[model samples]
Target: MAPDSTPPTNEATAEFRAARDHLLQHRGDIEGARRLPRPEGAYFNWALDWFDPEAHGNDDVALRVVDLAADGEVRAETALSFAALSGRSGQVANWLRGLGVARGDRMLLLLGNQVPLWEVMLAAIKLGAVVIPASTLLSPEDLADRVSRGEVRHVVAESGLTGGFAGIGGDWTRIAVGEPVAGWLSYADSAAVPAPFTPDGPTRADDPLLLYFTSGTTSRPKLVQHTHRSYPVGHLSTMYWIGLRPGDVHLNVSSPGWAKHAWSNFFAPWNAGAEILIVNQPRFAARPLLDAMVRHRVTSFCAPPTVWRMLVLEDLTRWRPPLRELVGAGEPLNPEIIERVQAAWGVTLRDGFGQTETTAQVGNPPGLVVKPGSMGVPLPGYEVTLVDAASGAVVTEPGAEGELCLPLDSTPLGLMTGYQQDPERQAEATAGGFYHTGDVAFRDADGYLTYIGRTDDVFKSSDYRISPFELESVLIEHPQVAEAAVVPSPDPLRLSVPKAYVVLVPGATADAEAARSILEFARGRLAPYKRVRRLEFAELPKTVSGKIRRVELRGRENELHGSGLTGGGESPARGKLEFWEEDFPRD
Candidate 1:
């Protein structure tokens, strides 16, 4: 179908457009963008109020998914224009309504990166149903927990994943996306429904829209609640951070069911009227990924630090993508990785900082001076502050480290309502009139923030504070190291010392020589007190989302050393490939 010859104009859209344009106009000027007024109103439904109107008769390709074969060859491809998607989602919405799905009902959406994921998201929004996105990697146990804790009233999952929910008990409707499932409704039947979906009622700005289960790295996952305005309208800051523009093809390498997926794949790019490009691969191969980027001419790209680290291992200069902007998030990008990419591609990989509870709060937006280690200043619409961890007072002196915080006095629209059903935890997080991020960082004189580590991840050695991220960053710079996690090793004298769990790059042997080389490399780069006293060669424990679970490593260390006594020996625990500083002969 052809796009509408002319775009529709309305007051709500105009307000959103104005706010977006203001940020784009001042993309390089952080202070100026922050000064712009935030968009506000009572009644707003992004799908109906913004997306439908913006997508009407819009022939521009809004979504493109490139499928890769097992051999890393491009097998099949699909593209959906904005107008077609708007119309299709309407049909899905009408069909879902016919199935007795009502407004404000919670639905569990479990699928991979496919067309139905986008269709169902839009359909649920149009129907005013709350969505809980679950990763396909989730186990049956995980599904049951979500079904119970999320109060899910409906489920939309791929046919292959239906079995995972077999033993799960829930009073929800099951809708399958692929081939025929016996007891579930077929999602393919939505096409038979009519277009032009009509909402039962207006979607209020504060209406519950999404419930996200955070990746449980330390404890059980926390249920985060977001309203209609929280993600849809909130990602304006994310769009600004990525420097997205209308018609730009933006590709973000993130898995489905994560907040980053919604941030870039759904809200950020769509809000900017940009095209979302996806390359579906059975497994990630850097060569195939770069080929897709070149084939699609991806203009703006975002990926987690893990992807960036892997990409740098390959010859990045071989493929000169037409990328104008590159970003790294999920974890802070090391300075070495950023510099290598800059040298190869002539484009600096900007670092961004945010959690599932919020949108892009800080980032190295385009046209700004790229800081070596800092994750840039606060993005537009966020008033970021550094508060002392102990005193709870805002830290004004530069170079002093503190807990990163967002004051509740001017909470950005992107911030989540709170941890769902956990008022006590919420109160603790929001204590002192601040939304404590529970992350630690230090600000420079120029207001740039450099991530130290998570508050819980930081430890003390001989009374000196040690940030694992700082040590890990230096450790990865060694050629043999692919990934490293730092945790506190119990000590009888200094209380605790930094210990490293190292994952060597392919072809690197986990021998005493290799361990000595890594420890010596880090010893020269890190301070005396922050030196990695003990080293082990093993795969680091990680959350499903790929975040290192340092807490698990700490527990293992304490469990091994029950008495917290090393006996002044070199190898504390035997048979675990453990290496210590004393293992090497002294000059």
Candidate 2:
């Protein structure tokens, strides 16, 4: 398909038509129609539009990546003007073309947050190749699975990771960075070629741009596919959410190979023409990251809740940066984390919600009042609804907790095309003309969406429904608690009760006294129905991508406290152990 150079107009395509109707009926009957405005003649082809050598002319500092080493040494600094990056990536594109890398071929990229990563990314995008970004942390077993299941035709990785793909099969072309490998092309050599590329075919807006093998938290990795128009254009909402402006330096703490990386690093900032600032480090250390932000004069920032929680453990008052905005994603941000950061920095931390399948669906947009513990309202282009799981119908009544589903009618540009090669699963997911998020939320009367746990994570105890997020939020408010994850533990009498796994802050001892204090803290904060009856202190299990694995925690609880509450059910009761409603005024 040829690229549509006629420009997007007021005309409503089928996806747009359906999306508009759904939003009008549910979110804003009158104002919804006016909010969704299409772009005119604005092409998101980074190679052709932003990275043109002649277009940029002599402008320096198009992108700058900073590497803060683990040994407290500054490793390298890479700055490429718009002209240089474009020309270098163009040479890489030409080199790849010579090596039989055709347009739309799947290429697996396993590299760190380095200059070559961005260069190769632009080159592949210009050549119209579907990139599968893999983390350098993957083992041979993981590599073989992706190579076999992802239908990859080319392998591009750092020299350190070349041995990890030792026995991977197929006629996959090998391209290595950093060092020479037998039978593999050295990526360093691509720079020596002619620094210009001419495309053989026009690029389509809806062409498949990226193929991601999602981090399998529960099941096998699913290939999540995105079109050129979907991600590059769709992240406009993300730019709006972060309040990113041109020339603003934005740093996002996310690893490569994940969707969040592309969400913040690639499109969101670039969409607003902001400088993408990166702090590349071997191991995560809070002080170095904070110092770099101050040195770079970073204005906007985003991080997963895990990183935020870790940072709060240190003395936040010890460092100050020129930060204007801070945002959290990947997981719901607890109210405690927000409060701590705000108290220290005088800047409120906002939270946004989305999945691997889409960009910022719900977020606390700029100029909006961010409600504590709520993930804010739906993004401008998304028509989000709380649909009843049992009835399979949209729930309009306020305070009704239901599955978070996006209507098919709201054809947001950021949504994935479909799960690659899985029609049956896709059909089940997109049932009833909606893309089911599999997550639950409750929209309050004022229109803010409070995240309930995942559909499988929410459960009932003694006929009372429980939201782990609600309890966990309250748990973190305790001074000693650094992070918390709440889930149902089986009980014979109550059927199930909320159990908490907590990480303590610095100087907080994991003793019976501390546990008791946290229990009392939760008792005062949460209602009787949402009390944390049992508590344990242990490192939370997380996916390789850093998402808390509640599913795994739930399994551990079931194994330990089978079928009911018992005195011996607790796992080495850390800190001071205390129970809610035990000494409280009970009805």
Candidate 3:
């Protein structure tokens, strides 16, 4: 099954490789990377043009997956070389084409971090079929919504998850992996068809390639569409921002079916010719994760802020992996998490900002001066502009707060074409010539941008604007506090006040003493206006993708503690274990 396939000079491939090499050569210089040229391929396919050629005769481990039990015990592990995957994907592509899959076909990919998941994705790319990545955690209702809205004509799901698609009402072809299914085509059947895949025609760069469902923390998930070039070619910034180098072992702790998975696991690593190290655990345990990092000799690493926060709780000094680059994404990273990692590994855990709608727009790239609590400067090719939400005027002064946005007319290749079939939402998002990110931030004099809260998450207290992120960052610094979410609590005199919902670490009780300790710690660090006036300890609600749902916290506060004049007409009942600033004694 060994295939030595190398396509000749493709404009897209050549252009992409040049940019990737330029970024790697000048990893320490942001300005040099910003000068890297964008790709201009009229017809391009990343799998055919970039990956297949790069993977030709290359035996480097492209993907390494380690599965662990709930107690951090390794159960199963797998590794695949670049050449092996390329050949296997070609077989899958040829097999899929025989099963009626055609160009522009829509496919729903619902699986975990298994080898087949990667296989189908590359196969779909080679076949010119659009892919919709859905989490395995989704229920039948969630799958139904995606199936209908995504116009899915083919579905490739894990065998156990096929039941969720039952009676979902789609004419789509059903294919299962992992085991035999009565009415499904086995993905295992692809092996029998040995002919290598050949594309019917050139894949237009503008053709739809990937469709993503946003992790809806605030509202219904939006359908995000990416073109052939958007994610495949657009993640050069992400690779550069992560300081990805060829032949390096890169570990991105993320789940499949999410944007970060594609950004870090699939595209970014392969673009750099690096190995993607995956750790699959039944339950996340810090020790086993650290063990894998050290055992694998991981060079570059990326994880969500939640994972970093948990890692800091363990004895960080215990294992020092040979990690050259570290990054935190998914949410704005807390300063405490960054500091602890730096102390333990002597390498700063940098933070980056991006979303399902775009690639890494802003980040603290490698060799840059790491700034405390700042997400750092805009990555190359992203022209970041801070605009005042109310006045619609560009905010130029340092320390001035504004909505984080990218100019629409000059939008980068990474941005989604637009929210699929939702023109109203698309227009609203692109109002005023900017692809509004709906996130707020303030800039420093030296041009490093700090992430404030989301546009809806930010609130006004006593006529002063408040950023929940600013307060929550200080809250997690307390030893007792594991995680924190800040929301505005209704008040009679000041309209609303900042309130915090805190999650304590293991074995920490949610009692008056614990609340007092966190409150006192935050009071010392935060300003008077942003002080958390009320505190409650509870497990924070989150989206399936692990993002904290601050919107739910805001609703709970309004429904419970709204003022007599604000919304609720009478005094609201206090939540159990809730502690207030007034409940503590005066200094």
Off by over 4 Å in 1: 1-3, 566-571
Candidate no. 1 TM-score: 0.98
lDDT by residue for model 2 (454-522), tens: 898899998999988888888887878888898887777788888898899878888667777888888
TM-scores vs. true structure, each candidate: 0.98, 0.90, 0.97
User: What are the clash counts of all predictions, listed in order?
Assistant: 2, 15, 0
Please provide, for model 1 over 539-581, each residue's C-alpha lDDT reduced to its tens digit, 9 standing for 90 to 100: 9888888888999999898887756455348646542788888
2 versus 3: better TM-score goes to: 3
Q: Would you list the C-alpha lDDT of every candidate in the order shown? A: 0.90, 0.80, 0.90
After superposing candidate 3, which stretches have Cα over 4 Å from the reference?
1-7, 563-572
Ranking by TM-score: 1, 3, 2
Residues 365-447 of candidate 3 have per-residue lDDT tens digits of 98899889999999987989999999999999999989999987776868889999899999999999999999999998999
Q: What TM value does model 3 have?
A: 0.97
